[model samples]
Target: MNKELQKLLRQINDKKNEVKSLVNDGKLDKARAAKEELKALQEKFDLLFDLDEEEHEGIEDKVSRGTAKVIGGEKADKKNLVKSFVNIIKAGFLHVEPDEADVKVYKDALTSDATPNDEGQQGIGVTIPEDIRTDIIELRRSSDNLEQYVNVEGVTTKTGTRNIEVDAESTPFDNVDEAADFPEMDEPVFEPIEYKVKKKGGILKMTAELLEDTAANIMAYINKWIAKKTKATRNAMILKVLNTMTVGKEVVVSNLDSLKDIFNEQLDPAVAATSIVITNQSGFNFLDKLKDSDGNYILQKDPTLQTKGKLLFGEYPIVKLSKKTLKSKQILAEDGTTVTGYKHPVFCGDLKEAITLFDRNVLTIDINDKGSGMWEKDLTGIKVRDRFDVQPVDKGAVIKGEITEVVNG
Candidate 1:
């Protein structure tokens, strides 16, 4: 799937250049055709790459929660919340701060579980612990329905879910809006018993321990989030903007091609602008901003937290963000780079220029600016192993050497 997206990217870059060249050459007809073709290709490409919704049919689905905009009623929300909670697992926020004092930094296990068999086995989901939750704040809708979540935790990686309560005399049809709607089952279909996390220590103790691993773990989780969020947020934002733009006429954008190119540009300068500086300077200079009156970074108040689908920034970034949106507005990082918005630094420009700016002169672009990972891109995935699957040699075996001509000094 990725290989195909890369191919589509090449086709897009080629077509974009071709259209520009044709326009200069006075081939209006060809240019128009190219534009139309580009639109079609982009639609197909986005469909392949877009990550707004989880693919329930695949392994990714069991591990991934469908889009963040989970549908709801009484029963629907409960199901969707469970699904979203699963995504939190994949998002790596489920592995909350353990009371392990010896460790300075920790990472969530990236393995996941799917379809538990009768023997207590199933395909692995993302490698989060069996219980990422420490404590659950419970809420109730009625006598039979109850919801649980953690509100003031270090991160907002949890989904609100209603537990379906059952009494000895209650039948499955007791909660249904109308039993005639679906005669699929004769008895109540109770959901599995879900557990809420319990804290291992007091607030202060947990705070101190979580801070120990905050710098490294936060960066890792947030980076993965941008990739995942950008795909989802862009889709939602565009749909929202479209809804706002047309005001109900269902009118497409004034320039559909340009809109897509920008939305699917893969490098949203806006997001890069937010996190680049923060990532580099996260720990020392900017941690204060995330801190509240109690001198704690709001997001790091707990260990089992990750801010979902939102990019957070420091107050100083307000002056830099000249656009309508001010500091800390929910934004997507350009590309899937691990940028710390409030502390680290990011550079955004032309793809060629961005590479030169971000990597400086040290790195070389092997594929040139030929379409990169343009479609069906997997922004976030668990980093279980230290090295990539493509890295052939053993880790320690790889060496870095440079040829140097001996000069008589």
Candidate 2:
């Protein structure tokens, strides 16, 4: 070994140690200086290592993974396992918890080397965050009548492209004094303003480990949502899914890849059975096992399967359900909550998609009779606001106001 070459090798190792200390101390400036020194030392190393004829391609060593992976098992999978993984992502702990990775690096004055944290030094000046820059092509803008969807990744994937109506137009308000006399009042002339906005995004890329953590977070949130929605829908969807997989009353996994990994089917059925039992012991599927054939639909024994018309208050609907399905009944939703089926099931019928509707009774105002003691029977050509106040409600509607004095023959 040449004496000079050995000295340069030792210098590189010392610089590597200095970079670690600087990074650990959160001294980004000193760390950068140490990194530059290491880069210079690497050039010298290349010359020395290349003294012999190189038989390889342009790049010497190949990276197995594009990015790093955080692995953890039995001993260290504690309550704060996520934190441990993030510690590796950041290459070390920081004084502040930056909301995003790039923000953390920027606040710590990160350079390319400070990013990927490769070679364990401040890293090569790779703009880690600015890797996936994208631009939006705004196809259309919202008008007074309808609006179109934006072509963002999440929107396109989840909602698909569709023309949707939106209340994007803003109404102009005119100053009005209700206390003043009608002659002096300025009837606030109203108009709406319509406009649109476009969005531009910066580049974004993530380490494999970072992406896994993010995916885990999204899964956790979605699972929480599924749990809450399960109750609201009365355990309808997931219960149905679970029941399809269950044999008799017990949950039997006919096929599960993760389960196969843990215990082979050839090993023992008891282990798999026990695992399924414990997994489903959450009481979440209690309603699922209860079937309509046993007569427990809607939690009422001998429950009426046929839909019935609402008999609001003491007055009952004049129609009755026949063996034949009701048709041509218009579904209406006013209060926008509790929906009921009218002549037909307003919620479900020949409709392509599942939906709910509410019935809002139409109001007709009659003219006041002589002396205003009674109202005229005629109700025609009356403006909605003139004859009566039409108040829309979920279960029932309300109509209360002064009748028009003029009656139409």
Candidate 3:
């Protein structure tokens, strides 16, 4: 199957170049014929790549709670509460001496589930107040991969295992006749993915002057930093899991011709109908350069244009990552020369079915205004932690393409 697809793509690319040259030389008739041939080949490729959603039951439907869309519902007002909390924390760090009412506002924002301190106060160690937790969660959701691809679950406990049914039922349904033999029934395979809370944090050093500058939008600055660090940490972990998944299909493409083959093959018809091609910005830039022999861009923009700025390769949406993210492992040329840069991996398929993420949902923060050694320096320490794991449940749904510099042209 791969060999056939590869051959077909090479033919298209070759024909495209030929048609362009023919038209440039005023051979309109020849160009038209070649264009017709290209059209036929494209139709065939599309047929092979078109996945029937009814035939392939998505793994997410089996056990996914959908991606988290924080900052909605009855808790909409929590958005402001979160900002208020940040302001209170900023005051503490700067010794700004906020009013008694301000302290109460920050404390009151703690989550209901927060373990009370000895003084029966809300939350532990200046942790993100409950109302503000939504903001943090929403920020984490901004991770390029986490919210888009992974099956995000909001779990309550810090340590636990997610029991997932890995396999579909093996029995075939058959019509029964009077006293017909019964078909054998099989149970789905269940597996547990254990997740532990991992700590990720950063300390912001505020100058006494900046802290004391009441006019400064310190809350916004702190919030942006919090969101940035949170996404970086969580997305890194998500990438780790995705890059290692047992891809159901893979193709090595050294040139545009072969790249198209791999791209088509990755769109498995057995998976869900909605699919996305994941690549970094550099990889997308390479794709952007792909042109038909007629000098028209081969990559099509999404016709509907309602995909939140997602471009399309045929019907599949492309999710562009930041530069260097989604990188392929190092490669060596056939002549034994080392490939200098990363061959960014182009991941494509029904990501919702391909990856599962277990999120503990709670962002725990521990603040130390006076650590044993820090008291002397008057440094305030903020520690944040969250629990989550990204795992592949249906590896067959994903296809990977390791793209190197050779494919750029």
Which numbered prediction scores highest in lDDT against the true structure? Answer: 3
The numbered model that scores best in TM-score is 3
TM-scores of all candidate predictions against the true structure: 0.18, 0.15, 0.64
Query: What does candidate 2 score on TM?
Result: 0.15
| CA lDDT, every model vs. true structure | 0.28, 0.27, 0.58
Error of 1 at 300 (Å): 48
Off by over 4 Å in 2: 52-409
lDDT of 2 at 42: 71
**Candidate 1, which ten residues in sequence have the lowest lDDT sum?**
356-365
Residues 215-309 of candidate 1: C-alpha lDDT, one tens digit per residue: 43533443343333322322233223222322332212222242233233433444233222111222212323444456645332222224221
Candidate 2 vs candidate 3: the lDDT winner is 3
Cα lDDT of model 2 by residue, 221-301, tens digit: 323332233222222221232233222322122212322333343223332232211111111122123334455421222
**Model 2 Cα displacement at 67 (Å)?**
34
Error of 3 at 160 (Å): 2.6
Ranking of all predicted structures according to TM-score, beginning with the best and ending with the worst: 3, 1, 2
lDDT of 3 by residue, 1-409 (tens): 2335435544654566567657755789998998999899867865653443431233224324442122222342554555555555665454454333333345345432332132421222344655555555565564274565767765444456666676453435767789988766566677777766564566654444445544336545555667777777777877776677844445664656765664455445556366677788777777778876788675786777655544544667777778755565665656667565556677767777777776655555544455455556665565555556666667767777766664331
